[model samples]
Target: MQTTSTYKILVVDDDPDIVELLHYNLTKEGYEVEQAENGKKAIDTAVAFKPDVILMDVMMPVLDGIAACRQLREMPEFRQTHIIFLTARAEEFSEVAAFEAGADDFITKPIKPRALLSRLAAYARRDAQQEGLDEVIEIAGLRIDRTSYAVYKGDEKIILPKKEFELLAFLAAKPNKVFSRDELLNNVWGTDVYVIARTVDVHIRKVREKIGEEYIRTIKGVGYKFNTD
Candidate 1:
């Protein structure tokens, strides 16, 4: 079992058995675990607990997981929080809906302890990697402050969505290094996230539109490279 004493996790599910199982396993793994029987309670608990990760069930009383995720994403405090959905429905559309609703990842029903632990480990690694990154990065007339979550092109401040800002910062940290879409997805979205490769392309296009095309170069049949020159 991994020790995640510093991290807080909220488990939301109407199933008492599932909630008990998660709470017990998570607590045994050294995490500070909290539980809510429904999405409404989850939201209330999240507001007070400020958990690092939320394991939410799709079907529940009052509010559903997708709706709860959307609500949390709208808040600035939870903009970067990881929300992983637990769904029994294996339909492709169901998964798509969860992603569209701002879920970061998903766990299929009858969650295995090992698989759940693996996902949690991935999140921990991502969080540690981000904590080690330099708070401020300046290069090629671009200034990025990870602390304030701000970006600047020369003297002008630019507003970017959370993912776009993270994507740009990840590339700018090592200018001239070509990064494959898989690398970008793993670093920015975490390895457990099940997003298509086109997701990276979409973000890249948005970033280019906002910051000009000169900053990022697309290598056909290869990947993308950040060009300082």
Candidate 2:
């Protein structure tokens, strides 16, 4: 895992206390953290800082997290920003709204430090891959050399679970092409294993988390695709 100090993160929220609390823990873990008090500032700060991931509060003053995220999506530099919403609301609509607004994940507060760290680490792994350079099997930024289990981005290597690494290799071989969950199970995991479709989402979600959201695109109502461009 890449050290947190190497990763930059943007936090968007209306509450100063929440921002402070988050910053404290994030820093304690060695991550570089920046704060944006409202929706508009979140976009500006995120673009200016180019954080590895954004931990955004759904409700904020000025632009609000959802609006800010939409704006962020317009910037070419952040086409792949991993946006995780920090919200008090956990209703289905709220969750759907977050995803619809381009959020990558959701974490409802009161915060669980350990769980939060784990999720953040998972994202950081994805971010680190953005700089990888595995020429043999390249999918956007992820690299996989069948001869070696190691995956590198630029000069930095990414640590991944066995299944995760294999899954990535399978998908990177065909960048930006749509693949249904069933197809992936048959091609990557094989059809013999009767896995639920949620398993595919979970792995794809993790893949997007480590590789950046722009690294993959969801075809809404269809399947997930690798974003070759």
Best model per lDDT: 1
Least well predicted 10-residue stretch by lDDT in candidate 1: 191-200
Per-residue lDDT value at 125 in model 1: 74
Highest TM-score against the true fold, candidate: 1
Alpha carbon RMSD to native, model 1: 3.6
For each candidate, the alpha-carbon lDDT, in order, equals 0.84, 0.71
Question: Candidate 1: TM-score?
Answer: 0.78
Task: Give the per-residue lDDT digits (tens) of candidate 1, residues 41-80.
Answer: 9999999999988999998999999999889877878877
Candidate 1, residue 135: how far the Cα is off, in Å: 1.7
Per-residue alpha-carbon lDDT of candidate 2 for residues 12-131, written as tens digits (9 for 90 to 100) = 888888889889998998989999888898877886898877899988777788888777765656655667788898776776666556566678878676777787776555444534
Query: With candidate 2 superimposed using the best TM-score fit, by how many Å does residue 37's alpha carbon deviate from the native?
Result: 1.2
